[model samples]
Target: MESLEHLTPTDREILNKSWAIVSKDMQQVAVNIFQMIFEQAPDAKLMFSFMMKDYNVTDQDTKTRIVT
Candidate 1:
């Protein structure tokens, strides 16, 4: 695994700032990210049994289940 010790203070600051912006709409981001993952790797969806049954990426319940 990569160590955080390698990250410079400036890098950490930039990451924090970027995360702050993305965290504003984290629900949507998680949905979009998972959707993309499924699209890019159709087989990946198979790992999640819940997705096999009437899966809908935009559904709030599905998004909640995905991120949590």
Candidate 2:
């Protein structure tokens, strides 16, 4: 995976702002994936449920402690 260290200050600022928007889109995609899994394989719903729960928890913690 690539890192953002190579980005210039302006580029990093733009990327940060863009990421705020992209994160919401990604959350929707995550929910869609979870719904698909739930409909297609009921047994796998637990995995998706746990995964999404952890993601939300971590995101909230990070937003509160670091992002702000």
**Best prediction by lDDT:** 1
lDDT of every predicted structure (CA atoms): 0.79, 0.65
Model 2 residue pairs with clashes: none
Model 1 spans with C-alpha error above 4 angstroms: 54-68
TM-score per candidate: 0.71, 0.33
lDDT of candidate 2 at residue 52, scale 0 to 100: 51
* 36: Cα error in model 1, Å: 1.2
Query: Model 2, stretches more than 4 Å misplaced?
Result: 1-24, 48-68
* CA error at residue 16 for candidate 1, angstroms: 0.5
Predicted structure 1: lDDT: 0.79
lDDT of 1 by residue, 1-68 (tens): 37878999999899999999999999999999999998898768858888767554445755534221
